[model samples]
Target: MIRSVTMARAVAAALLLLAGAVRADAGATFRAQFGDAFLDRYWALQPDAAIAVGYYRYAARIAVPDAAYRARRLAFLERSIAALRRLPEAGMDAAMRTDGAVLLSQLEQERWSLAEFREWQWNPSLYNVADAFALLLNTPYAPEAERLRTVSQRLTQVPAYYAAARAAIARPVREQVQLAMQQSQGTLDVFGEALERQLAGSALRADERARFLQRLRAARVAVEGYIAFLEALDQRLARDGGGRDFRIGRAAYERLFGYAIQTGVTPDALHARALQEKERLHERMAELADHLWPKYFPDQAPPPERVARIGQLIARLSDNHATPAGFYDEVQALIPRLEDCVRTHQLVDLDPSRPLAVRVTPPYQRGVAMASVNAPGPYDATAKTYFNVTPLDAFTPAQADSFLREYNHWLLQILVIHEAVPGHYVQLVYANKTPSRIKSVFGNGPMIEGWAVYSERMMLESGWDPSPEMELMYSKWLLRVVCNTLLDYGVHVRGMQEDEALRLLRDEAFQSETEARGKWRRAQLSYVQLASYFAGFSAIYDFRESLKQQLGERFDLKKFNDRFLSYGSAPVAVITPLIGAADVSR
Candidate 1:
C-alpha cells in the first residue's frame, strides 16, 4: 500500500512536469501562456493571487500551492523561460519587441527570487498567498464546491507544508516560535473571518451549512495541529543549535531587490535620495500650509501653537467630513469628473471599454488605511479595475474625530485622483488593452507609480486647485510619498531605528501618532517599495517633458497617455527605449 501511494505521488509529479513541458512549446502568445499556466493555477487556490491577476470571482477558491506543486511550478517557470528566450524578436513590432524583452527579463528575475524560498518563509502576513485565498473564499462570487475543493487541498497540504517549514529554518528556537505564533495568529484571524461569513449566511441550505461548519472545524483543528508542529520544530532547532538567524545575507538581499524591483540602484543610494526628497517635500508642505491657514495666525512662520491648532482643526474637519459609506460615494462621483477634466485638458484619451469601479474593502482585510487599484492581467481584455478604499471601523467619538481630521475632504479628493481617474485605474485600463501581454505583465513599478504620482502635480498644473487649502492637501499627500520613500530606504538600508523613523514621520509628514506607528510597521515589513512612488514619478515627469520637446506640437497629452499606457506595465528601462530617444524640441 505504501509503495503504491509513493508511486502514485511520483506519477502525479511527473505528469505535472510533462504537462508543463508540452505547454511550453504550444506557441501561444506570452499572454495566453501566462494566463493559462500561471494565472489559472493560482485562480482557484489563491484568490489574492487571482485578484492580483484580475480575477476577483475565483479568488475564494484558490489555495496556496503545496511544497511539491511549488517545486513543479518553479521547474515549469524554467521551461517557459527557456522557450521564451528562443522566440525571435526581429519580426515583432516595437511594442511587442519591448514587451518580449521585458517579460523575459522579469521571468529570469522571478525565477531567481523564487529560488530564495527554501521554505514557507512568508506565511503569516496579509500579503501572503494563503491570506489572499482566505479572503477570497469569503466573497459571494466563489462557488461553494470550488471553495471546498480549495479548502480541502489546503487542509491536506498543511501538515507537509509545516514539515517543510520545520526542516528549512536555520534559526533559533525563539525566532521559530515567534514565527509560528505570528502564523497561528494570522491563520486564526482568517478562519474566524470565514466562520463569521458562514454563520451569518441565512441563504445556506441545511446541508451546506453543516458542510461549512464541518470544514470550519476541520480547518481549525488542522491549523492548531500545524501550530503544534511549529512549536515542536522550534524546540528541536533550539536544542540542536543555538538560535541562529535565517535572514538572507546582503548579497542575496541585493540580488532579490534588483531582480524583483528592476532597480539597479543600491539601497544606500535610494535611501539618500529618499532623505533629500523628504526634506524638500517637507519644506514645500510647510510653505503651502503656512499660506493656506494665514487667517488663524498673523505671521508667515511655523508656530507651534498654530501647528497644534491646525492639527486640531484638521481632526475636526475629518470627523465632520467622514461618511459612514466611507470614500466610495466621493470616489465614484470624482471618477467621471476627473475623466472629463483629463479629457478637457487633453491629458489622456480615455478608452471607452476600460473597466473602472469604486469598491469597499473586503471585510476580512480592514485595519489598513490605504487605497489601491488592482490592475488587469496581461491577456485579460476584461479590464475589471477596482479602486479599493479601506473601510472605517465603527469609531468611538475620539477615534472618529482623529480619523476624520487626517482624511479630510480635500485629501480624499486627491486620493480619488491618485487611486482612480488619471492615477492607477486610468494607467492600468490602457495597459490591459495594450498590444503586448508580456509588457503588461512585466511593466515596471516606477512607470506605473510614477505616472500616478505625476498626475497629482498635473492636476494642479491644469488649474484643478488654486486655493491654499487644496494646495496644502496636495503638498501633504506629496509629503507622504516623500516620507514613504525615505522610510522604505531608511529601514532597509540605513538601519534607522523605529523611534527615529517615527520622529521623521511625525515631524516631516505631519502624521498622527496612530498613523506614524502604522507607517513604521509597514516600513519595516516592506523594503524599497516606497521609493518607487517618488523616484518613478520624477522619472516619468522628466520623460514627459523631454517627449513634449521632441514631439513639439505633435506632443498631445491625450495621445501620449494613450500610447504610454498601451504598452502594458514594464520596467522604465525597456519602456524608455520604446518611447524613442528624447527629441529636444520643446
Candidate 2:
C-alpha cells in the first residue's frame, strides 16, 4: 500500500511539471500571435512600409491620414506594447527574444515619433507622392495588371489623402513647403513621362487604361492645387518674417538619433567623435596628397603648407572627368572591375546570379542626394538592385563640368564600391538570407550607410589598385563622411549657416564647390541622417577590432564579413551583443 501511494504521488508531480512546461510554451505562442497581430494592424496604418516589405495584402490600399485613425493607432500600439511587456522573457526562445526586442523597439520609437515629433505636421516633403508611386510601378513583383491596379488605386486616393493631410499640418517649415511644391511639379512630370508610358504598355483593357488615365489626370490637378497652396503658405511665412526655421530642434534631433542610430549614445558623443575623425582623416589625406602631388603634377610644385598642398592635390584629382552622356555607361563598365576587386580580395562572397540594374535617377526621386541603391525587398526572393546615378542634364556646360569634377573618375570608382559591390548591395543580399523579418525590414540606417563607407576603406586596405590617386580620393571621401556628420550637427544643433557649412565642406573636407552646395541643401532637407555614416562606421570598426583581438590568428575576414552581414542590419548595439565572441558557430 505504501509503495502504491508513493508511485501515485510521483505520477501526479510528473504530470504537474509537464503541464507547467506546456503552459510556458503556450504563453510564448500567445506572445507571438499578439505580436504578429499588432504588426498587421501597424502595417495597415503604414501601407507604404507594408508594400516595401512585400506585404501584398495591403498593397492596393493607401493609409488615409485620418485624425481619428491616427489616435486609434497610437492607442493600439500602446496597448499592444503593454501586452508584449507582460510576456516574460523566460517564456521566449532565443529567436523570439531577439524578435521581441526588435518589435518592441520599433513600436516604441514609432509611437514616440508620431505622438511627439510629428514630422507629418511640420514637413511638407513627408507627404510627397512620388516615392510612394515609384515603389508601386518599379518593383514588378506582381503581374502587370495587378501592379497597375495598385498604381491606379493610389492615383485615385492621392487627392483625398492630401486633403486629409492638409488638416493635420497646422504649421510647416517654409523651406520644406517650397521644396514640396518644387517636388510636386516633378511628381506630375513622373506621371506624364514615366508612369504614363508604363500604364500604356500594361495588359489592361481599354476601359481600365481609360480609368487609370482619369485618376492620373485627377492626381495631376490635385498636385497642382497643393503646389498653389504651398506657394501661398511660403509667401505668407516670408511676409510674416517666420520663414527662417527648419531645424527639428535639439530635443527631437537627439530622440531621432536614438531611434534611428540605435546606438544608445548621445549626439554630443557622436559630434565629438566626428570632430576628432575629421582631423585624423584630414591628416591622412594631406600625407597621401603630398605623395601624389609630384606623381600627378610633375611640372608644378605642390604648395609648401600642408593645407594648401592637400587642396591642390585633390583639385588635380578632380581633373579627370566623365561627361553626363557617357557617365552612367562608364559606371556600368566599372561595376565589373569593382566585382573583381571584391572577389580577388575575398572581401565577401558574391551570388553571381543576382541581377543589378544601373539607371538614371527619376526626376521626383532627385530631391535628395546624388547616388542611391534600390535593393530588392527581403520577402521577394529574386534580387534586382537598382544603382541610380543622378543626371546632369539641368546644369550648364560650366556647371556640368563642376558636377563631373565633384564626381570625378577615381571618386566615381569609390562610389561604385560604396553602392554596389561589397557595400549596400552585397550587405543587403546577405541580409535577405537572415530569418528575422523585423531586422530585415527595420534595419539600422546608420549601419547601412556606415557599411558602405567602411567598404571604401576596406577596399583600399585590401590593395585596390594600390595607387596614390585612389588612396587620396578615398581619404577625401572619408573626410566628407566625417564632415557630413559634423556639418549636420552644426546646422541643426549649433545653428551653423550656409557659409560655415560651405567652408567646412569645400576648404576643410576638400569637397568641390558643387558638392558643397548640394550638401548644404541636403543638410537643410534632412536631420541626423548624415551623422549615420561616421557614427555607424566607428561602431563597426571598433566591433571588428574586438573580434580581431578575441579571434587572434584564427580571424578570417571573409568569415567575419559574412557572419556580420547575416544579422540582417540590426543596430550595431543589438548585433554586437547578439554576436558574442564566444560563439564561432555559423
The per-candidate count of clashes, in order, stands at: 22, 0
- Residue 217, model 2: lDDT of 92
Off by over 4 Å in 2: 1-27, 34-36, 197-201, 297-301, 582-586
Q: Please provide TM-scores, in order, for all candidate models, with all chains considered together.
A: 0.74, 0.92
Model 1 residue 134 CA deviation (Å) reads: 6.5
**Tens-place lDDT digits, model 2, residues 362-420:** 77777677889887667774746788988888888877888889889888888888898
lDDT of 1 by residue, 33-143 (tens): 554465455344444555655555563343344566557767866886886777654444455566566766776766775676343444322212344445345433456
Model 1: lowest-lDDT 10 consecutive positions: 120-129
- Stretches of candidate 1 off by over 4 Å are 1-67, 82-93, 117-119, 126-213, 223-253, 263-269, 286-290, 299-333, 351-355, 367-369, 375-384, 394-400, 580-586
Q: Give the winner by lDDT.
A: 2
- The superposed Cα distance between candidate 2 and the true structure at residue 12, in angstroms, equals 19
Root-mean-square deviation of Cα positions for candidate 1 versus the true structure, in angstroms? 11.9
Collision pairs in model 2: none
Model 2 TM-score, all chains together: 0.92
